[model samples]
Target: MVAGGFSELGEEGRMLEAQVKARINGTGTRVIGPNTVGVLFPHSALNTALTPNDRIYYPGKGSVAFISQSGALGLLVMDSITEFGMGVSGFVNIGNRADVTEVEVLSMFMDDPNTRSIVLYLESISDGATFFSKAMEASLTKPVVMLKTGRSEESSRAASFHTGAMATDDRVLDGVLRQAGVICAYDEVELLDYGKVLAYQSPPSGDRIAVITTAGGVGVVTTDLLTTAHDGVRLRMAAFSPEEKAELRKYALPIASVNNPIDLTADGSSEAYA
Candidate 1:
């Protein structure tokens, strides 16, 4: 079995034997990659890696499967998600997707009993039509949240620097992702936040958003944000109810404009969360 990226030759062979020997009495079985972080079936306790192996700190296994194109980035996400208290059923770093493409991994997760959600961080979409078809099918069964990069001109150049991938059109990709019901994260923080939100929070039944802020100025900004048109989607604010307007005045300045962004005039507290 190949360990890492290199196969065992004469000198490397001796080193490999010694390392494997010290770990498991020289009886370590066939491993896929020596330079790879082991895959974990958190529910099954099946760790297929040649590294110091254990799952002492992994969160409770659940229905989410995280599939990443870059193994290193995938590991980073794993560490972050663990700290954030998100649970996972399986993790696959489909390097180059050489043998295992996103479609295959997705299909497997679809049939997997434990997987409930799927998180994807892909730099490239290899086969657009195929990915969309499979993603649509999987999403019908479970939600798929994606943090895709390399869409913009600058980001495309940056992606090539990190991973020799030929960047494609970001606009078309964005359309495809939206049409497929895949949520896109604009930044890394948003990526994790949205991932955690989608993983734990219930999907909004409707797009009606009520913003409660601490100041009139903040409310104004929020109103602008909701009204500002970007891409094809425009935020359509629902008219506030008479009771909702009254609630806004309780915490807002006497002169504060009572609108969609109901500012509490710097008097709101954690209790406002409802």
Candidate 2:
């Protein structure tokens, strides 16, 4: 049940929102949002988004549960889910959060057997302590990745205007989230990418990774990216032994280099990949 013109507009809007919240104070029913597009459980075919069906198609069933504070951004992400090759178990648009907040939705997702990972696009946090505690608990079982915007002073002011949210210090927020075991994403793409990877793959037992590519430059870039520290996880490129290189050369082209990346050159074939 999402209705805009609440809280973000002015005093009248805030009063209206307060009244609405008061009405649901002691009810059996729980509301997700008063100013939101609403929730979507894709696996169950339950979609309450205000966005028209024609504007965004279902991204198919997945194990990632997404919660967003911005309705428009949620819709945009939903529209791109298919392109991103990630699916959704559930999606929540927690706009204004007059009644329900991100903490409640996060608890639901954490207990949901269908959800393997959680992603969030948050403009602000309503309750910092509760959010940190809930996120820490949830991340113990599944990955909780967040894309928190409004880092800049100008952007924070803009966010206040957009959703009536107060901005916290970015550095402190980042440290708090990290300490809570939440993976912070810099942008929407990183959020989706993290979700996609977590959805499709098991967590690596070790930080050592091997890269194999036909293009040398691509392998180099990937190696560079992996070796960098992310959320305190430092990845190291796995080194191939001489014997390992010799065995790989039997399958690779003569010109192929048998380094850590194992570049197979332009003439690399399917057998080389195998």
Highest-scoring model, TM-score: 2
Candidate 2 local lDDT, 124-209, one digit each (tens): 99999999999999998899999999999999988888888889899999999989989888888788988888877756767788
**Location of the lowest summed lDDT over 10 successive residues in candidate 1:** 1-10
Query: Candidate 2: where is the Cα deviation over 4 Å?
Result: 10-12, 84-86, 229-234, 241-243
Instruction: Give the alpha carbon lDDT tens digit for every residue of 141-211 in model 1.
Output: 67777778887889877765543445878878878888887766665556666556666665566766777
Q: Which pairs of residues clash in candidate 2, taking residues 3 or more apart in a chain or in different chains?
A: none
lDDT of 2 at 160: 81
What is the clash count of model 1? 8
